[model samples]
Target: MVLEGLGKSLRDVLGRVNSSSVIDEDLIKDVARELQRALLQADVNVQLVLELTNRIQDRALHEEPPAGRSPKDHVNKIIYEELVGLLDNGEGLELKPQTIMMVGLYGQGKTTSTGKLANYFVKKGFTVGLIGADVYRPAALDQLKQLGEKVNAEVYGEPGEKDAAKIVKNGLSKLSGKKIIIIDTSGRHALEDDLIQELKDIAAVAKPQERILVLDSQVGQQAGPQAEAFHNAVGVTGVILTKMDGTAKGGGALSAVAKTKARIVFIGTGEHIRDLEPFDADRFISRLLGMGDLASLVQIAKEEIGEDEAFEKVAKNMLSGKFTLTDMYQQMQAMTKMGTLQKVMSMIPGMSKMEDKIDYDASQAKLSKYKVILDSMTVNEKDEPTLIKGKRIDRIAAGAGVTGHDVRELLKQYNQSKKMMGSIGKDRKMRKKMMKQMAGMDPNALQDME
Candidate 1:
């Protein structure tokens, strides 16, 4: 539903096909139409989307899929491949101790992403230092210090250094222990001469190994020009898109990668130190198309379901719609294996800002209550939601050690799950759309799963 409009467009084009049969030009055109519409809706540059779709159409009509693949399957796979090809290839930075600079406009997550980047390097076994070169901003130094403390990285800044260049020069001079030194620069609301001069001066001082522009994913189409503007001024080597856990207008970041001739090196899914991930284009666009990011899911599962039994339990439940609160509780616990709820929420686009309004501690406590309720029920009752009637509800309430209302809430959630699965199963349009989404899956892995 998040991609409601784009969903309609995709269904309109891809919905016509139902089997593994060969497709015609009409079908390809329709699929291209839907892709064009979805990309535009996602705030992709109009010219780029058109060009991309044109290539898709040509490939669908001209190229042959692998053996036994259906026409729809062929097109779906082709689109996935071409889309990745359209995105600029990811470039790896030289794995040496060197200076890296963060450049962006105000409110673009420059400082936040810098800290995350530093944390990323530290985990990768690099000693990293931070030079708070944003002396223009009143609170930049303190903010970087607080962030540095979280990552246990060194922060270099004096109490009242007014010149950004001076702070960077001093920071670099004293830098001894770390291989990578990240200089976080200040930004203005728009491109201004003073800020530009200061950035140039910092670059001259640091002679950075790489200068990365931190672009906000929410900026959509505007990301391209903004990236170009910075690239023109400071000559960015790579870009990092942040706030990827929110309603990320994904097209913008993709466009930024395309427009600036700069590769995306990392993405910021959360505000936490470990929230940054190295760029992987195929997985990223797959999720953008509402197909799900299985790689990310696999990462989560590896951490949460370290036990084979636990992994199998949730995977079976997810595919069969037999999920329960106990199951959900285990899933929640699995999620916690990675980090706190607040940190996890920041990784999911729609779930961002959840802690801002939701009662986090209470919500976790509710999960615990539901866990107890499920534990009280017979295994059969846990499997079948419809079987939990009044007497069972009371027994479960007493067993879970919560109010009867709590049992009702658990049933409510289960009902919601059933309704959603049923809707996904019954809708002809949804089936066709989901089939196209199957393109994102690794055919070998899926076959193995089957």
Candidate 2:
């Protein structure tokens, strides 16, 4: 969650709008002012913030609600659109085979971003090859190689080589078979002449289809000038903002780069190798405003679960209200594969609004304890949890190195999940309606669910 503070502020203001009895001039103005405050506090440029707030205010006050749409829903729609307008407008990169060269200043997580980019392509079923053309920084090649290994991509690096252009030329020849070839170029402390020259030379030899400039979101307002400089030097086609998950200044970086010629193509959401996500302004803003991104969630679920019969069976069992502890454990493993609970929740249709209320850290620890408890149960106990009571609970607790209370807690959670799933599964109309709502959801429509 990038710019979480700003998101919380915006959601709170929207919550007020929904609860208000009247949507009038004063309420619109108040919402505008609160939005300005939130964006400014998140390090968005003052001019951009004013411009965005102005648009939101004008639209909300003047635009008539669509037929059957309430004034509150209309205002929320205006806010969602205006906020999305503040970011990238260009079509993102194509998934076909292409050469991509990564460039940026040192310490901007450029090397790590290379790995992330490679992972993104690999997940798309591309055969990725990483070229470690970064020669200046000590261990830069080693780091790239390690990341390449993590993503299972081929790496071509000439260690101790001084000429970056020559290394890229040779590496391109070596890794030409890969569908996606990403060259990680050298970086400097600042936008220096030497670094620019090196990038130019590498681009000349590589003729990369995409020259992506990586920037640290924490760079704040400086991200604009940096992007301009790189784009001028090597015709940077796109930008990747890193460290977005932990930075308040991500809004600044995002807004500033959107002003530049190089539009954001990807964003590094976290430290994990798989945290890089394709930048979609609509989806990004939807998640930010506590409206879920079901498209991205489904994509992640597909990548994690695929067509596993075991998972399908577990899901069916859960829906039938006949799932065992073993089935519950399988479901937990699938969720873990998708992402952190907070991230998964943010992608659900209406769960993002509950993110702040839940204690995810405690919940994650509890899940771990439950896994240990499940591991200690006998096969029969796992299949029929109701059978484990009294003495049985005590024996399982001792086996799991915990008190009987812990075992009971696990059962309580399982039963709750089973009950909820059963209710949803039994109601065919409710399930179909939910699926329809998710399949063709408007941003304003999210408010109804919330």
Candidate 3:
């Protein structure tokens, strides 16, 4: 949700281009101005905004559309390419055995990010450990320990140790067998000399493979200077931007960090540990332009739903018109694992534009209640909801601690799904096309079926 306003503004500009009868010099200028305004409003540096918009304007006015591409498509492509170039550093974190040292000012979510980073690696089947060398902040080690517990990673720290270098040495000795070791260093209110020296000492002792600077998204245009200073002091190799879900000025932080030529390794999209995502310029810009990040969606689905056979089974059931309340319940659980409904919607092309029209909170609450109601049902009831009559409905409502009306509403939803699936099943051609689409066999062929 970071830079939501900027995304909307850019999408609006593209919408105007697609709606216009003509793509002319005037339209290009107008688009450039709109983009300039959006970036500036997002707290991006004025000079950088001008530079980018000028490039966009030049390409839009001078470049000819490809043989099959329309003028609008050509201009959109140019904008997308420029935006990608602006953010991408052409580098990524090496996923081999390495020690990562986190450096940043205080209150930048460094400790939390350490946990998220460790979790990310662990999910990739790597053994990870955390070294809490943050001796300045009270209870920092305890916080890291708690997060380590949550992520099922080992945490190393000496409670009364005043020397961070000594703590780092000891942690390394303790967690030497781990594939990835992350050292969480102390931070100050500003980039003070002592903090820099302490980081230097810890780095010397840990001999980390990557030195990452953790930045708060709210830092806005200051991100560039901060990154530069840190890079100059201790040679920062990568950056992590945190609190991206809450900040309107996320564009500023991203652009500023990009300007420093530091590769952004990851971004914290939400508070959940699973909310962290590896930064990919193409996917990030695709989502911003309402084109969806299908790769990320697929990855999350694969993680949540297990093997490919499970999805095939679901597709077969839907095509056979045999979907039950149990299937719906399982789907809801998978969706929850993927993320919030709104997040899932945003990853779907064209659905981001409809976010305002949907009551996400109410829908989420309804989903929670439905799950609880389903939990109260027996296997027979889940497979055959029609078996539940007045008395049975009352029993389920009591068990689920909901009104009878709520149970009826859930049944109504199930009936709708069943009816929809039945219709798809009856249309053999449509069912085949749908299955093909789900299998990612041929999307264009499915569109042709329409």
Model 3 is weakest, by summed lDDT over 10 consecutive residues, at: 434-443
Off-target runs (Cα >4 Å) in candidate 3 are: 292-450
lDDT of each: 0.68, 0.75, 0.76
Q: Per-residue CA lDDT of candidate 3, range 282-400, in tens?
A: 66676676543332233333433343334334545665667888877766655544345555554443333244545656656667788899999999999988998799999999999
Per-prediction TM-score, please? 0.65, 0.65, 0.66
lDDT for 263 in candidate 3 is: 80
Cα RMSD to native, each candidate?
A: 10.2, 12.5, 12.7
The residue-by-residue lDDT of candidate 2 on 1-450, one tens digit each, is 566777778777777787899999999999999998988787777888898899999999889987756688678778877877777568788989999999899988888999988988998899999998888976998999999999989999988989999999999999989999999988888889988999999999999999988888887767667887888889878888888777454766766566665678988867889777678776577667654322223323333335344444545665566777887887666554433545545544334333444565565566677778888998998888889899999988999999999898778767655555555535433443332221212223434444
- Least accurate stretch of 10 residues (summed lDDT) in model 2? 435-444
State the lDDT of candidate 1 residue by residue for 151-241, as single tens digits: 8899999767788898888898888677889999999888788888888998987888788999887787778888888888789888888
Model 3: residue 38 alpha-carbon error in angstroms? 0.8
Name the runs in model 1 displaced over 4 angstroms. Answer: 1-22, 92-95, 292-450
Total clashing residue pairs per candidate?
3, 0, 0
